[model samples]
Target: MKIDQLATRACAPPGLHWPAPAAAAAEPAARQAGAALARQPGQAAEQALQFNRDASLQQVALDYLGRLEERAVGVLQTLAARRSASAESALQGARAGLERTLEQRAAGLGEVLDGQLRAGPATRARVQFEVAGLASLRAVQAAGAETLLFSVGPQAGGPLAVVLDEHLGPARLLRRFNASLGQAGVQVRVEADSRLLFEIDEAAWPALREHLAIRGEGRLFAATGWQVPPLREQSLQAELRQAPAGPVLRALGEQVLERIRAAREYFQQQQSQLRQQLGGETRAAAEKRRVALDFVERLNDAKTTAAGAPSHFQLNARAASVNRAIARSALTRRSVLGLLA
Candidate 1:
């Protein structure tokens, strides 16, 4: 399902399921202000209770993610072959859980995102960037499609997500960047959805932030209260943020369109290269390549339901097919071993 729909499924509010005893607790919180001392004579015990409740919720959320992270990391570390898939799925679940918890906590403060934005339908693209890491030099192609990615780092403990390519809107980048920085303990005030100003409490390297801002556009979003590092102490941090489009970001969107058309052609070359690498003169590794390729195709076919729709049981069924494929692969391996014997 689409991320928004998935969140709704999980965090639909508790329906004011106030407990019989707790009902009285809400009664006096609003009136607690009226009881304020004419001569500084009273304490707002009710308001204090509310504050305590909110703090408890925050701790609960933190504890949940911490425990979940430990479990996911442990399972992923041990499950060698299937670990990547498990990790991807687990990452999505954890991030979604965090979003839902925050949504509930922030509802009173008007901080939650509208469940599913009623924007234009998604626009997509395919872009190529020249990536050079010494021996890793190559032109890498990536699909700039409308999908959400949860980015995390020390500064970005929370996930920020972008739904689509910037050609549709720069706001997407800003939102994702905001969430990412938000989780990092940065204070972000989006002047508007498109513009952001942030304050970082602490940073490992400050110059890199300035450098990125310059590339994005001068003061596209200002950083305040940051202590600049000396030239000698300054550091270069590689790949802090994923590739994003600038204000004048080339609408290589059309270029991306052209490249999507080139994909069938590109696929032929990729198929050949993969086959040759695996199906070397020494022995055929086509079996492994086949297993991996089938997975790649299935991933391409999955689609999410719209925002308000019920769960797409059909998609879940397709996901099960993936499990069946894995089982069949194991069975095939056993059969091959028997034949060899």
Candidate 2:
């Protein structure tokens, strides 16, 4: 029979019977003590013999139980250590995989930004033109009566007009013109020397230039220095050299970079959690092993005391009770492998 089964039978209630003892002659002193106790008086003699027999059997059962527990604990400790090591290795591998995925995503995001940056100019078109001495034009008629008329497209409505004030500077004139023409896709600004610079979308410039007219009610277009200039289309290469990626493309790149940063932080947190879990498992296993070994030591000590004092009925009964409690405790506790399952 297993040590556990024998221990359980040895610790049963006082009236329950068991099969014949297997190692009855192993301890002659215990047998002789039982024989001597049997010679006492009436039923008391039989009770003494039974107590001695029970003590000897309980001691033998506890000895076997202690040895079995020691061997089982050793096996369980080795298995637990191996499992912990394997789990740690798997955790490290998972972390490495996550890091690699994050790095790949980051690299892909960089490539996308670089590609967008390189292709920025091809998707945009701009046209620029400058008007000469247009800032100083004055009315050939009455002062403040001069008006500049601007129109876009052949079939558009009446032209918009800007009244020339004597005190109007290029900056104020440009702002007034933009306020009128901005919806038509034309933007005007003042450059150095009070010259007017006009920017128009290349797609709209052709139609705008075809039927566009700028008329001043004065010597504004005469040789007195005011003149309208032809539109100059900026080359794609020149635009590329001068401009960074457009706002929309830049925003997209920034979003990708932010996502990459978030992914990195998530992976780092996962790795930290894995490390903490591994450490906790290691500590818990160590504590469980310590408790199991300590219990085995106490059990061994009880067996030794029972063996040395066979006539001490109180000590024998205590050891048997301890054995039954340990059997019940062992049934309730699960090994590491069991918990994992």
Candidate 3:
């Protein structure tokens, strides 16, 4: 139903002649007239024969042009069909390749993300000390000057010598004694207008307790009107209460990461199958792939965020140590004045 422009241009018009039809029609009459001139009779016949031959050659050429047009059109249609098939095949293959590439990349990312989500354990390295409550003491007197001495360790590794002035009041004397003890690396606090408050530093308590053998012949506390009530001897012990909530949070985090991973994989697989089934030039397939890829990228970002969260197990362990230290402090602080006495 379609016209070929090349064929139409190549063909000659109907009812038209290479030599004008009017001129051909006049040829016989001109020959007949020439015959009447006996002197030019043969020349007229020869001219008539040449005219016929020319006409025949012209007709043959026109037929050849028509056939050539037909053949050229056929060749062009064949080439176009072949090219179309080749292009279609190549496009399909390209889409398949791209889909495979996306799938492989997603798989690799999933592996890395899964590793991060289920990451390994970590060591707890932080040391903590927590103390609570207060201790108190009244002043005491010492009996000697310069000669009076005190010892901390059972073997007396650090010996302290004290000399008391009787003229100083109990409060003033206690203040002076505490000041001197501070210079000797023994920290103490006075409170309640009369009592001393105390709690040992966790870091220093262990070593100090192991060698504790306070000796002062009762003078260090006795000289300041300080009373010594036998320490209640509360047991120094602690239990881990209220563990770090990291484990619960970590478990939930891993679960969420797993969901993201599953979603990413689902989309990746869907896209791969789509590519294998459809051509790259297919608009529907391309749209689906775009959507799937976008979701995968979003899920990957979420996975990265989940992987960076703090480790709950490690946090809980550190918290437990801190709780133990607090409990130990509460137990160990019986009386501040007892240690000095």
Residues 226-269 of candidate 3 have per-residue lDDT tens digits of: 23233221111111011122343234333433544554454345
Residue-level lDDT of model 1, residues 205-226, one tens digit each, is 2423343221111122112422
Clashes of each: 1, 0, 16
- Which pairs clash in the backbone of model 2? none
In candidate 1, which residue ranges exceed 4 Å CA deviation? Answer: 1-44, 78-341
Q: Alpha carbon lDDT of residue 301, candidate 2?
A: 51
Q: How far is candidate 3 from the true structure (C-alpha RMSD, Å)?
A: 47.4
Q: Residue-wise lDDT of candidate 2 within 1-341, one digit each (tens)?
A: 69999799889999975533423333454445334333323343343344334333333333332342343233233333445666546534433333233233213232221211121111233456554435322322224445767767654566776666666655676677788777677888755554466777655666876766566655454323323445444332223233333343234334433443444444344335544543464455456445544544454454454443234675465445444433433332222212222
TM-score of predicted structure 2: 0.29
- Which regions in candidate 2 have their CA more than 4 angstroms from the true location? 1-124, 132-145, 222-229, 234-341
Candidate 3: stretches off by over 4 Å:
1-148, 153-157, 217-341
* Residue 200 displacement (Å), model 2: 0.9
Task: In model 3, state the lDDT of residue 73.
Answer: 38
TM-score of every candidate: 0.18, 0.29, 0.23
